[model samples]
Target chain A: MWPGPADPVQDLIDNFADLDSLVRVYPLLLQGFGLTILLSIVTLPIATASGLAVAVAYSTAGTGVRRMLVVAIDILRAFPVLVLLVLIFYGLPFLGLRLNAFAAAVLAIALNNTGYFGEIFRAGIEAVPPGQGEAAAALGLHRMRVLIHVILPQAIRKVTAPLASNALELVKTTSIASLVSLPELLRSARVAQEQTYNPTPLVAASLLFFALLWPFARWVARLERRALATGH
Target chain B: MDRIAENYFNGAVIAAALPAVLRGFGITVLVSLSTIVVGISAGLGLALLRCAAIRPLDIAIAIYVDLFRTLPQLVILVFLYFGMPYLGVTLSPFVTVVLGLGAVLAAFSAEIIWSAILALPPGQWDAARALGLRPVPLLFLVVLPQAVRLATPLITNRAIAITKGTALGTAVSLPETLGSAQSAMAIMANPSPLTLAAALYLLFFIPLVALSRVLERRVARAG
Candidate 1:
């Protein structure tokens, strides 16, 4: 749901185009920026872990388990991250599960990422020639060992570029936590926007977002270049 | 007993959601259609410029691609949507999102199309020039057609990018499927409608994802 039209930041800017008011909100914006990064950092590992588990479950689950996992992942992928955050943060309390807005937003977004990333990892595993997997099995490698040794190294390499892009997506998504008043980057900017009536200050945070993502893209490109150079 | 009751509630919510959900579907379809159209045109223009023999122009377009492709769409939308209003440039949320997202899609598509263009046999361009097809017509008719053949799957992926990208709409409070669902759920006491909303989104996303995959295979076959 949209925020109420308090527009505190906008008001601040409207009342004074002075750099002073904008500067005053700098700390708030910084806090938001810090929180946004923290959320993404925390969410990434959780998402990757959950995603790995789900991928395993999808691969190893019996027909019934696989079907259930597929349906769950399908639903998760289809569900909007923002809407789910709202539901979990606001609606779940009535169901006796309670998380504050920050926790709820992170949980929801991380859960959403898990579905797609799980599928990505699953696809990565599937892309490994079955012969390799069979060879591992013949060597007496347990399924777990086979996966750890033969599949994951290659899969991690395969997914690195997409995972980098996914990280960019997750960074943008943490902004939605603002909707439930999580005091994130956008939330801080929204606050400043209402207070100052000037969104130019938000331009700073946007630049930071761009700054944070640009390196990841370059890193992915660098990885691709190295892979091509090595002909791997 | 609880299962029966829950199913009945779900049925009612589904019935209620049918019209609005269809409207949501309509919006997504339109967004997808317009995005592909506008996106491809911009993408083509960009790819042509970037892949042009002119070094300066190529560098400029490369920078554009890098800037937009690297950043997340929501952050850009926020800048366009909430940031522009203070400058006395007001756009409705829907327009803000569509254009903002269309720009990002164009940025990525340009790279995909440019690579596809580069992949074509240089002989094709040579033959076109020999036929006196001239620069513009040759690029449009001979060059782009082949580029489209190669770019089709990537373009479809761009389409999925835009489709999934609409989730960013919720960031700007656009009443798309997810937004409408959230507001509706807020008003309703039960989660049944949220459940329905999730189902409807799958009905949209799954097909798009699957179609892109199929299209990718087809393009590979054609290639």
Candidate 2:
């Protein structure tokens, strides 16, 4: 099914002969990978909070805020993350101050994630029993306090796997960091590809991505099974 | 940044890219539409396969769905772009993009449509069969309509996903909205209308998807 790359199997061996060069770029790649994790971690919290808030606003509030949030969420959800990334990353500098590549990437992703997270949180919170909210209200708890102490905890558990899955998507999406001259995994691979004149580095970097993502994918799978079994 | 603005919307370049981008958008629409067509049919077939009593077919669809679901869209795009060209097989950017989108969406779409199918209680299928509803009209007239109605909201989400995934066509230089903008910016050395280009993308997508959601809710409610 494939042609021999000289020396029979040795061509396969030789294709990746530049593996050692990755050692130098490894730290750089690790930094990029670290930044990806940082992006996801940073996004996970802020988006979760805001998404819950947005969801709450819509679920409870009048037509004005609900309609605004609906339109906002719809637009953000429909647009590709990269498109927004380009807009935010480049658009912000035009406004005066500028974030570095990593900050911009993180911010762009976080902004995109916030809409999604908001919907997820909204759904999770909505899944909570109405009686629970009523009880919390009956206890003289403020809406904010009730949300914080009563509703959010259970909703958080309901939405954990989804948020984690979104985190996994963030891992792959972070690969776009290469475009912005970020020293992420994909960018290092591109650099190594140029330096060694081989595709091995790119493949290695992809493998690195897969290695990073597989655990989360598996975890999500397990969580899905649990959710199913529990009849969530 | 200042110099980049000078060439932002060069009439000549935008004109050159316009035909190409329009053609690319056509291809995008074609791909998205075809993916919907093929993905829906194939997805439904797979869903039916899993629902069938035979373990072999059920197992086969399960693995097929799993394999396609687990693979990344980028990998599939790269493979179709780079891999098939070597085997005396060539495809236009249009076909490749459509096929790639179809391949990715089919797996998830199948499961989504299947869940919708499952939601109807097994009694529906039994009821159809008991009424002497054979496969064709039973599916075309009876089952799929209801399933489609049930799946409307989720399908809208898939529609948005498919549209976003089509942006990947820019990678192969198909001159879609993003590709034209990249070329425009690259030649002009200006990134201003990259803003405009981004705006145009949001312009194209935001309303289209919003309307689709409205349609989804309407269908969902009607169903």
Candidate 3:
């Protein structure tokens, strides 16, 4: 297809950057990309809210409740998110609770992130000085009001950096949804690569991820730097 | 409950799957250990080189670190294992998993150690220089130890996370823990092997998770 005999550079272009294959797979790639974004959007809030709930419970609960929370968090954290996803996607049906691929992926990821975000939120809550709550109570605020109106806002702000970092992690992790036949971006690229016998789609998908994620990564770094400079 | 036990926790299936799963776990250990060695050393090496701080080299290293940080390990593995054959550089599944994960871990380690070095008070360098220690002696004796201590907790957490990615090797058909259990499931037509695999992973990783907590506490206290 080249005007002259093929060279190494031409071979690489054909193999990894073949425009014809890229065009063919572009629609499938877009569909998968949309699902990836959808998964991330759906997961982030559920994980953050649920994790916040868990953290708040830990803070206010009795020792038994605290112990149970810790055990649950530790177990979830110990299992690699991939393994957790597999267990849920495959093992749930045996118990007669069948979840579709998207639901299964969301459940597994949300569960995993709940553990991580719980810890992050717990740390954020603890970082709020005790005086903040005392002063709120002194002002006649109810305990729940003190927690919601005073402490939580500051706690979430304090944890903004880790929150963003975890969010980035969640987006990247959506790739694993492909493993369960979810046809997310990575899976779509795999399908395209197989169908076209060219790997260009994989490269294109990677570049797409890098483009989507790099700015947020840089933002997280800046946040981290600000957090470090401000110091606790 | 009985049905759940029969499908997922059957004793006979567990016993039958145990041997293959154990063999796969052995491979997991091998791959993880070797990847750790390669990753940490290469990471430390890159961090050390970055300390020298030539502009072009620093930019190149930054790009490498950022690229790896952003790309998922699975994507990298897929590229290397499947795409690279087209470029005349096919890698075995074992090599691909090790190299792919090692590269990612190295990126993280480099960042952690670099930041740890940056976190060190400048006085240490000034004091070491005043003592007549050369750059090499100064870095090794004075700077690196403190930086490494600071970096250790973060690095340990990241290493555990990345090494757990050995299960990702199943994508390339590396017969690691997850892969073996999967095939065993196929042969036995039972999901019990997967249960065994999860148990095995929990057995290996839960302690490490607990240890990381301890390390985080110790480091915080020391600081």
Candidate 4:
């Protein structure tokens, strides 16, 4: 009566928000959800630490070494995370280094994230006034001690917003691991959708992602606004 | 080193795969450009509508922006390409990628543009009004240009970042650069096409990255 074949609302409900299929797919989605979180937790620290280390080296290195580091960072940053993932996952076997899908996803994402975090750390470090370093040096602090103890605290504070933003990006980026069959949340949803001949699982997965990420997104937005207000 | 070059940088495999990779590069460029155009325009429209400050409309726009911002583009693409058919609405992979990435980009750009508009001095609006410019004319002639200028660097960065999602089109088999390269790698039993694809991506994106850096510096100087 309402349309050509059936009610549009009912069709949408059955296709998108069907509770029965959602319930059936919940277990698989839960497993994938855990893996997604695990991937983020594992990759974030490795990326951040190595990226910070690079930024430190860049600050201390000679001009030639600094130029080489900048070139490498730019190339890595310019490379698409997904292509890097594909390259690591599919292209690495040729070099006789085979990684499983999960390891490849983590490594690829870490590499990409490091490029970004390195740039952020460099900017943050640069933002600190030179006087601060001189003051630390005049107090007989070693260069590394000044950087680690005095300079880094201020640098990290200045860049917290960007760091959080990049972390959020990393969490979202984990979904791409699905493409290489890592059985993450998105992949699990796809499997369930195929099995049930329904899209409800996909909808559920998106809801899960939103539920996990929305708060973080809002926090990043708030941090950005505050940074803007502070004239950063 | 020599073996690495032979395996990944094979001259013959690259030559064999060049045509398909080029075709895919074309699709990648088409998708990226279409996404940029759609995203920027739609975003501007949404931001303009937002300027009206109607309560329900503002709420709806906020929800749209937040929802799109929260969901990953690949999830949206997968939903549109694979899930929509169950509801009797099907989009081709190309449309799906464009629509998904474009929608996400639109959300981000809308927020950036809206913030830029808000950041404009109130005096600008008052001056436009005093000059006898009607609301639409004031917005178009005075307000929007400033807002667009303020928003340009940010919108450019976000656009580049989101448009990189074009690589995700491989998931739905859109046969863009990465997809074609993957297929070539499979067929030629070498990863040369992937290497070539990486080089192509680097060539395209490095300039944009450098441009973003320049724009960022400009903004910092202006501040």
Candidate 5:
């Protein structure tokens, strides 16, 4: 006998056979994916630049300032990015400064990421030999020039693996923007699933995410292995 | 200022929402602890399998870890919560979140433990083999103890990060800390509940962050 409607296998086939359903939702999901990519692209440079500034300040500051900066970074690291997003998106309006959902999400994610990137950059900077800076200075190079020519390039290379991994994380994290009603990939899939009463769109979205992120993940893993092998 | 305080920082609103948020926090703790247990055990099992170096299983696990590692936890949760019903495997929201997050934690922990195992000097393995110890006993007795020590700091840090992910349960309407606070905010039309939730999050996570630091320092000193 052919499988009937009550058969679980039949139901599963029916559930997944909704290719038309998936096709309908594809554009929405694509737009959402575009937004996710955009958010990540925008967030990375901002977070990294601010993080570099913080790391530099922390390294060069007086002991009192360094202590305070350390505390601030620790607090920011401890704070959940979701809570940060919520506080900024929902709570900041209380302070008479309202931001749209996109702006709020970007600000919160960037702030949280800056804390992580700052710590990473600081470690990278420390990994460079202090002698390099002194040697450059002794060569009659200005302090700023020494930092620019001798320190940052090495530090950036050292931190590339962590930074790339963080960037991938930020990409995945764009899903969280759905909570604030930003029409990112997850939100689009959810909307489609609700409208169609089928899970095919969600599956499509998962595949889309995997397709987008897998290569980058592999690249980061490769970089990390190389870095580790080089004793960096 | 008075109007601002009345609308956004109302003490009464926060007080009224405190119980709900605390209840949600209790759920968060429960979910995190339970997932930690599941994740670490699964991770240990996977690491042992990986140590055996069977080509097929290793490849399978590598794929599994890669999939979980790269995919967003939110997507996984959505799939399990919404997609599984088609397969005739419906789970409660709590189970869905736990399973989703636990899978991620397991992948990370497995990697940490496997690397720790690799970092063990080759002599240790050879010495155990010479002692006429079989693979199972040798692994259980010699390698794992040292690997566990090496893996502890990283495992703890990863565990805290994953536990913080319990907040994402809100996306699935799990009524965890963030979810409950969101509902309270909706009902009260004030952000006081969210503020309270933020304070609670800080209170909970700050200590864990501090502890992770201490552990990291100790590990560095030991090395």
Candidate 6:
């Protein structure tokens, strides 16, 4: 009887005019947002460190090891992040290793991000010239010293923008954890929507996500533009 | 060994679930192809509009591109599928996935195509104008072919990445590859269906990934 599609304008207003519900769901959404941020915060460092290690190993490994590593990274990259999550969460129990939802999500996403970041790091490393390494060796610097002093600094500089972009992507991906029943932003939004039979919570969640991610997205865009301007 | 086989790698479970998974694969391919086609066509149109340099229209297109590009794909999918019914509009799951993914694909494609157009040497435009070609015909006849060629490798790569997003349809219960596998696994109580699903995904995407790689190398060499 009330705004049942007959009055389209009124219908639109009624759908979104629920400030009380919006305010009610705010704390729950914020809590979920906090967890999303924490997930990314925990993931970034682990992914970066492991990615660097994998890149370094790839560079120095023998042919067999290099081949194996390349194949593994390829498979990881090829699988969708969601599929990887499902595989790790569901498949691991069969192997007699069970993980809580949070742990499983972190492990799966971090592993996937490692593949991407390792590739970026390798490209950055390869972008450095062979002449620089040889010149350092000629100067009697030990191999490790040469790497730390001459190589890694430049490689890190080259890869920073890409690494930042990957971090942002990791942030967005943390939402997938909700599918495994983690009460992250998306799941919280779903819960609110079901509870109130209103979509305002979903809209609020989207706005929160945009607020959280838009600045990073713009920053990454600026970094890319600056890199391009510098002819990198 | 038998217990391990029964729980994780049960052959009977895989054989039972293979047909449903295959059907889901068909749906995945169809949805992906439909999205790609719609996305590319819409993207080309947007690129054309942007190239015309109409101020207000360009601003609107820019906003559309940025919004789709910045937001998570799942957010859009959930909003369209789950949130729209509240507003008195209902979209089937298939249409929802297509529209959601198509919009994203359009944003990327528009950027790529627009850049390709910009990268064309200015002299080509001048030359065509000197030959008495109007802007519309010149853009369609002289410029689009070369721009599309330049954009092909990038477009293909983006297509592969976005097409993988078809799996996100599973979130809406679309019964695509991942969804069918999840349901099958739930029914059989064995994880082998998931193993099968993973293999099917690999079988479907690995070739496209490799092809994109080759296309990238070819484009680089051509440049």
Identify the leading candidate in terms of lDDT: 4
True contacts kept of 3: 0.60
State which docking tier applies to candidate 6.
medium
TM-score of candidate 6 to 2 decimals:
0.92
Model 5 ranges off by over 4 Å: A1-10, A225-232, B1-8, B218-223
The fraction of reference A/B contacts recovered in model 2 reads: 0.19
Docking class of 2: acceptable
Q: Model 1: per-residue lDDT, tens digit, B1-223?
A: 5753453246766666666656765676676566667767898789887655798888888888888877667667888888776666788877887788788888878877776676677999999999999788998999889878776766776667566767567677676776666665565555666666666677777777667656744643443
Q: How accurate is candidate 2 locally (lDDT)?
A: 0.66
lDDT of each residue in B168-214, candidate 3, tens digit only:
89889899988898888888877899999998898998898889878
Alpha carbon lDDT of each predicted model: 0.73, 0.66, 0.87, 0.90, 0.85, 0.84
TM-score of chain B of each: 0.86, 0.78, 0.96, 0.97, 0.95, 0.96
The order by descending lDDT is 4, 3, 5, 6, 1, 2
TM-score of 1: 0.83
- State each candidate's chain A TM-score: 0.84, 0.86, 0.96, 0.96, 0.94, 0.92
Model 4 Cα lDDT, one tens digit per residue, A28-98? 99999999999999999999998998899998899999998888778878988999999999999998999
What is candidate 4's lDDT per residue for B1-223, written digit by digit as tens?
9999998999999999999999999999999999999998999989999989899999999999999988988999999999888877899989999999999999989988887787777999999899899998999999899889888887998898887889999999899999999999999999999999998999889998888878867876676
Q: Give the TM-score of candidate 2.
A: 0.76
Candidate order by DockQ, decreasing, is 4, 3, 5, 6, 1, 2
Clash counts for the predictions, in order: 20, 2, 0, 0, 0, 0
List residue ranges in candidate 6 displaced over 4 A: A1-6, A156-162, A223-232, B1-3, B119-132, B216-223
TM-score of each: 0.83, 0.76, 0.95, 0.96, 0.93, 0.92
* All candidates: DockQ: 0.40, 0.25, 0.62, 0.75, 0.60, 0.53
Worst 10 residues of 5 chain B by lDDT: B214-223
**Which docking class does model 3 fall in?**
medium
Task: Give, for candidate 1 chain A, the lowest lDDT window spanning 10 residues.
Answer: A223-232
Q: Over the stretch B1-223, how does candidate 5's per-residue lDDT look in tens digits?
A: 7877786678999999999999999998899898899898999899999988999999999999889888998899989988998787998989999999999999878877887787788999999999999999999999999989988887898788888889999887898989899899989988889878888888888899889878856763564
